[model samples]
Target: MSSPKQRHLLRLGLSCRKISAQVTNSATESIVAMASSTEQEFMPHYRSKLTTFPRPHRFWDANIASRVGEKLGFRLTDIGISDVEIEQPPLPTHHRKLIAPFLHSVKRAGISVYGSEKFESESQA
Candidate 1:
């Protein structure tokens, strides 16, 4: 049997075309994060979430705290999580010094560098 909220949603669903699977996991994570951050200040609520995924890692760990949890503020040591140090992941440097020169030389020699940021050459003035 549909609960009141479910029945209400069903009625709305007929009038809307934008239906998709529910956001159950994210919603639950947010609930937990909010409960955890009740007495917080300084960090904005949205910033507390650690949602950005930097590209360098070969694997993603699901167990890592949610973005909301991160935004809510966390102390890794107190959380009993570890490493002697903590640091933000390095961001990618999209520009390469050699890439511009290499591309110029190759195109002059009639070779085209193609596909992906790492190999693709950008034009420099």
Candidate 2:
């Protein structure tokens, strides 16, 4: 929903993940971790290896829960869940690009700052 990058990444990643999702009376959080081509290339194969099992793979990462469905499907059963809690880092702010202006100010000057040892000064801590 954000941009075309999602489509490209998903195609290369080849997920059964839906392009659009709806949650009913539930709060949802999205977490995006850097996905290397190597990881993308192997995720499908790794997931395929565990399709027959109804529970999480023995080595399945707990942090990647948001993007994985089948690995956590066993929690849906009537057996009940234990020792799991939702963790969040507070809600996001409206001003999304907080550090961009600082970056722009630093690089806006025409002079190249890298290797400019002439301007460097030591400060005793």
- The weakest ten consecutive residues by lDDT in model 1 span 7-16
Best by lDDT: 2
Query: Which model scores highest in TM-score?
Result: 1
Estimate, for each residue in 1-125, the C-alpha lDDT of model 1 and write its tens digit: 11223211000010111111111112232211121222234234324344445533211111121222232223322332221111112223332322233233323433222321332333332
Clashes by residue pair, model 1: 48-70, 48-71, 48-72, 49-67, 49-68, 49-71, 50-67
Candidate 2 error regions (>4 Å):
1-42, 45-67, 75-79, 82-84, 91-125
Off by over 4 Å in 1: 1-95, 116-125
lDDT of prediction 1: 0.24
Q: After superposition, how far is residue 71 of candidate 2 from its true place, in Å?
A: 2.5
Task: For residues 7-103, write the lDDT of model 2, one tens digit per residue.
Answer: 1111112222311111111222332222221245446645664575674423222223223322222221222221122212222231112212211
